[model samples]
Target chain A: MFNWKLLKTIYLYDGTLNGLFTIAFDCYIFKSIPSNIIFEDNYISNFLDTAIYIKTDNEKSSRIWNGLYNNVSYDTLYNCYYAFLSCQKNKEINILKYILKAFIDGPKINTMLHIDYVLEVMKLRKNVLHESHRLKGLTRLSEINKNLFYASIHPDNNVIELLGHFFIKRFPLQNLILHDKNRNLLFLYNSQNPNNYEIISSPSNFNISNYSIEEIEFQNLWKTFFKNISIKERTNPRLQMQYMPKKYWQNLTELK
Target chain B: MDIQEKLEILSDAAKYDASCSSSGSNRKNSSNGIGNGDISGICHSWGADGRCISLLKILMTNCCMYDCKYCINRRTNAVPRATFTPREIADLTIGFYKRNYIEGLFLSSAVIKSADYTTELMIQAITILRNEYNFHGYIHAKTIPGSSQELIDQLGKLVDRMSVNIELPSNDSLKLLAPDKSKLDIVKPMSYISNKLENNQRLLSTFSKKRNFSLSPVTKYQKEKFVPAGQTTQMIIGATPETDLKIIKLSESLYNTMKLKRVYYSAYVSINKDSCLPTLDKPPLLRENRLYQADWLLRFYGFHADELLEEKHPNFNTFLDPKCDWALRNIDKFPVEINKASYSMLLRVPGIGVISAKRIITARRSFSLNFENLKKLGVVLKRARYFITCNGKYFDKISSFNPSFINENLLMLEKRSTPSKNNYSQLSLFENSLPTKGDVIKCLTGNF
Candidate 1:
């Protein structure tokens, strides 16, 4: 019999969902527990512990995913997917433990909030969903040219991938690009291909300074309207900051 | 005047209306239009007052024909007046909509010339946006009281939501403060829009049922809706001598009789000084906040007006929230067992809201819940600990069930959370302490 409890090891992956799931597959095959799961780029050497790099495998990851689907509910599977996309610390290992526990306990593990791993995964999913929803409303698009519009956001989580479906369906006749400055990523949508959106790496020297001739005037009008609409008698800066935090003010037009 | 100056004067004048919501409409962009509506509503930004700026709330014109006592844009007030042509209004809305600065337009007017003429101008602007620009976004149009029923019907078909301000709560107050307007004028348009909306819903339901039974391809835009988001009304708080009980009773009737979507309460900021208006150092914001809490209880928490207030206790307690107050008044109903209580009973608890109650229902189905499980399920343990029991066991810290004991602890918690110097001042034997402007403002805005 394999003594899985005695063998504690560290795992490294290429920061992809398939790679993460491959680690889960290897753990169950070798009957060993991961002490930590670190991204390949962020990994540092520790001489006292054993570490192994897990390559991404398509068949093994899909097999593990199919197993989870048959055992757990769709909401549980999606929660794991969303939580994995979060930039939280030690999220990969936390998600791995959650999936392993789900396989043993079945779908009821989702409602077992008393379990620490289950609750952590649920919290991470909620955090990512909340930021994506807020950005949907807070994204301020500017007319970069006659046919193109642009918006820039610096969110705390990896949420830009979640906004494409909403914006594409809402603006089917317009071309727009949503840029995530912190992650150096771009979500580009064109009117010709309204049904599809493309994600690309943002160039470091992207020019955002060139605006259409009438853009400045409209921006000024928006700022004026924003200023005059607030009642002076009920100016609660604390409440305002609570709703739109100070960190998001850098990209908002009216706040600047 | 330039568009910049016109927008400034008009939006400033329209600021006191106090209705900024842009939700509850599910209109879609079916015809390759420029915009669509979200059913849950999206707030694009927060104002300095912490109000959601969901729409570009502006007026067609600030030129008024009536001299109401409490209005900033009354005939006699010497504020700058401006009017936007229909073309300018349409252009501004599309520009703002394309850039995502607003969800849509909130078009109101100040009875320029007459009600019919003002409604005509608003209809023209909306017509241009809907037909000419092919914009399908949310539009909330304020119906001018006493406008012709035909004009009201026309305006209703083009907008997502409509409202007519009651201005004052009581007939006597209306007669004294706004002599030119009457209660019948406001109610006539409100009932007209209400009946029209009901008929629209009936027609749409039958149409949908027929289409569902027969699977011929049916377009989504089969019928033109009449105020798809329904209608709402507003009344100025502290403008009249009506008690909170009277106001709440009126709101309950409006929700029942008129089938109104929302009833907004605006704290009367004393912008215009008149003998008919109550003289205040600032607006009664605490009273307004209390009224909103009571309003929520009426709408969502399955509460009646009389259950919250009585003739003797005609107002809400300034420090305690309405739900906590009600829970304490009927203490026998509480200390509800978490595992055995029904969903509605759980909602009656102090800290368990609709979401938490539903969560409890879901979480309890798998395993019997304990206090630790309850906290993880998003119940505010600080407040719910006093009212609920886990597995027939009360919280460990709560030694007594005396109402006064619980009240004292809750008050202490409230004070600790909102520690304000103005609310608790040290008195001196020899010197007199007058309220500074800052203290007065804090007291008015309900910071404590």
Candidate 2:
């Protein structure tokens, strides 16, 4: 364990929400502010500086979470969580600044959107949520092996948790497994554990789950319907690309 | 014909409908069913034309008896016509829904045999989807204008929403374009559906055990079920000489009196070479978009249709959006204080949307907001900076409220946001079409 008391300029963590929160807890306890925060995988020893390595502790993170929940507005907590979900580079520093501001100015710091850190966090949260909402609609479920409904998406943000909660309410009885292949996150939900889904992370490891015969036939039918539905005279691909961009077409059943 | 071929013709025919929204309906999948209606409709895919395909918008048949000149499937046209069996439609809907290809079904038909027969066929197809299949998904059915009230009532009870197209804006346009459709024949079903929805709400309010059922619930035990998503209508713009003033006035009446959920404006596509219809290479899409913007002003923004347009200025300006145009005309309301403006006043600003306005209201309660705060609150500072003040300091260098000065600068800002039609640039070397907003409006009016 690298000594956190050395007063490092940059703190490195494992790039988890809890890890970020633990770093925030250290900043408060040490009464020293770190200039930069980066993920552990991104950290390289710069001979000009001291480096502090922090391990994730759920207890410490939850303590900070509970403190915010009791002190600040619930909307602020959600904002912080959503901002953390953003795939933007160097988001750790943005979220850390927001947390520090939240501590200094009380819970109402979120209302001060003119503050650079608060505004950036808000923008990042909006991006995360906007992509989540789009994926909820664009998510296509296919049946695989016995009864599992499987879907794969490659959203910019880690939105599988958001998509999982949406599908759980939408299809409460069905077994579901949504894989965010971009982040290698797997969300598994069954009727037995419908409300609290089990999320696991690994490499992009799942094969195409052995699609049922009906699934293949229906996907072909969907492609047929997608082709037949468009008007020949009014074909405008620009508009379609505007709504559903080409970047999102790789995993889409109809587009594929 | 097989199902695939019939689907091609029917889906092609149904593309004219702008009522593709499956919103305002909520339901749960039944024990045996495979689907339910989403509260906010989901766009499973966008079509090549950029329209969202929320529902399986298809017609029961392309067979028609009436000779409406604007219609692609008019009786006079020699296009190959096809019809889908009720079983075929039901099968297609279920098959597609299970695969997540659609939210539900938007089943419509041309006048088959008679109005009653066509409506009955639609009802039969929907009935199979609802009763036989136990499908609880969103179903938006089109009511044949002159259908019997009994059939309309049966149709309304089965689906989540219904519509009766008002086809033309005025009686004269109907007389000229669709000699077979009388004004009475079209409006009768609209009134019937509107009255039925009101009655259903009243009965539910009085007798419903759960008054918290603001969200329409599809339970087997409920006694009454009307079109919970309500009714919507569409009018073919640019097909007639009706001005924007006339179009919105009719829309206002429909919204105010008939209790319509929405009024769709479809830019008229010049399909067949008819002497009555205007010749156009493309539909008046930008004009249609402008009318929709004005329509939003009426529905949500608390602006009257008269305020947006009147007899003096019968049409909307092609370059500026309606709200910005309204704000420019009402310059006296400008320079509203960010910390002091009312919600309505804040909403009237060009770049300040509903979300930003709400944020402004809430954020100001904590501190007196400044220009930086306004931008941070999601206000489009470029457009909004002219109309708003923070701490009594003007962001833009403007001493006068002259509309043209502001209008010109605002157009420059708008020009950045919307791509200028390069189609004009390509034609400029050959034809000296003046590149002005007026010329755009003139071109929109079919003067080209």
Candidate 3:
């Protein structure tokens, strides 16, 4: 007979949601108890049970990821990642474990609405969706050159991947680079050429001189235009600060 | 007068007019013009004050024949008057557009000669921008009441947007203050534009059926469409003895009856010391902001003016935002279960905005949301705490708290004193510390 306390073993894995799912799958398949579990890299465990480092296999991870994608809605995959990115607490792991178990049980799992964990995951996903939409309107781009549109965003979440769909659709013909300087990532889309992107840990030094004289002239012209429009009679510094916060102005070319 | 001096005087005189928004129209560059209205335009620069400076928002002339009590450029005032010729004004617009100095021109005028004459000059300036200069950008023209319907119709086709200021809410107030203006004259031009737009739309839709071939690529009906961005009117708040409820109701009627794109409320700043008007120490800016918030609720939040401020509670609570005030009044609707509530129900909560409400709706489709998860989703629990519950579990509440008590508590919380600066010596360290002559020039011209 298994002692419930002794049988319970805490599983720790990489902080990624995929790593969490693999740990959950191993515990379930082997009939081993998950006493108190956490993302392996986050905190040191106090449990005396045996520690196992469950490696994240690309094939198995892709199989789980792709299975969720093909069987479930894009929203489900998005929510799972959103909940994963939240870095909330151990509950997030349990939620992910429930999702994996349902997926392992086959396509029928998508129909169930009784699970509270699924709802919480969807909430996190909705937040990421809202942020992506806001970025479309609020992402103020500066003209670096005639062909290049440069914008730097310091988003609270990893929304760099999400913004690409909007930029691609809006400025289809223009060559642009949307740099997530916080994440050190770039999405380069050139109109005359096919679209291709790469994750660079350290991008080469940028030179402002590479911009055309016309582009530089237009930038100055735009700045001049912005300066002239403010009405002195209705100057409300309080309202101005509210709309265009001081922290955002640091990156805005017009503010400079 | 030379164009430069005339421009300076006219632009300075036009400064008092607060309707400078250049959004809504999505006109693009055609074969006829060098400019494109697709871009957000030059007035994108916001000042230290909340006003957006996009257009060279100036009048064609400030030499008015009428003596409106609320007007700074009224005939009685001893301010220098100037008028810009159509050619000079047209040249200024094109030059400014080329330099990216302004998005376009907001050409308003005082009753310089006659209503017809002033309207003619404004039309002439816009015609040059459209036909001669081939500049296709955002132009917001003011329709002078009593101008010919033909002139109004002609001008409507050329400009992107137009406005007819209702200056005062009631006709009685109009007679008391701006005696020269009449409600019929104001409503007449708006009716003409609305009819023209309706007629143009009907003509375009019918043309597709009339022709044996597919829809015409270039229809005359499209060019004749009146004010593509529609009309907006301004009302002077706190100028007359009208209550806040009266003003909001007027705005609602203007939106519903007039089908206005926007109704700008210019807080009465006491620019002119006329015996008829109130002598306020400062402009009721906070009140204006509250009115704007209420206006936003009316437009976006499916709220009526009466719901926010009733006949008894005519004035909005100065301390709390309009939404919070509304929520406090309806305390019986409090502690709405987040998981079970509808999208509209979630939106009614004080702390939850449109975005957060939408998130709650979509998220609850899959899971029952709790308090901690709601906070993570960026819901303002401080204000919403009294209103919403997570899975039927209440977090915070003063059980016996009445609306007045909540109002007082919220008012105390809202009392934020702007950090006082001690010394003029620290001024140099900050950017835009003092408005220099250069800063004024840049603010005026969109050139820094």
Q: Pick the candidate with the highest lDDT.
A: 1
Model 2: per-residue Cα lDDT over A1-256, one tens digit each: 1133435478889988999999888877886668788888878788998777888989889977987787776877788899999999878888877886786678778777767788899899999999998887788889896667888889999888888877776566678888888888889988666557898985655767578997787787677778877766678999899999888888788887
* lDDT for B319 (candidate 3): 73
Ranking of models by lDDT: 1, 2, 3
- Mark the regions of model 2 whose C-alpha exceeds 4 Å error after superposition: A1-12, A21-37, A48-55, A64-71, A96-110, A143-148, A190-196, A202-205, A209-213, B29-33, B131-134, B200-225, B412-448
Off by over 4 Å in 1: A1-7, A22-33, A60-74, A100-109, B212-222, B422-448
Candidate 2 has what TM-score? 0.86
Q: Candidate 2: interface RMSD in Å?
A: 2.3
In model 3, the runs with Cα more than 4 Å from the true position are A1-234, A245-256, B1-6, B31-43, B98-101, B197-213, B216-224, B396-405, B416-448
Write out the backbone clash pairs for model 1: none
- Candidate achieving the largest TM-score: 1
Best by DockQ: 1
lDDT of 2 at B324: 88
Query: Model 3, range B299-384, lDDT digits (tens) per residue?
Result: 87888898999888899887789999888878778768898888888888887889889877765776677877777666778777
In model 1, state the lDDT of residue A46: 81
Question: What 10-residue stretch in candidate 1 chain B is worst by lDDT?
Answer: B214-223
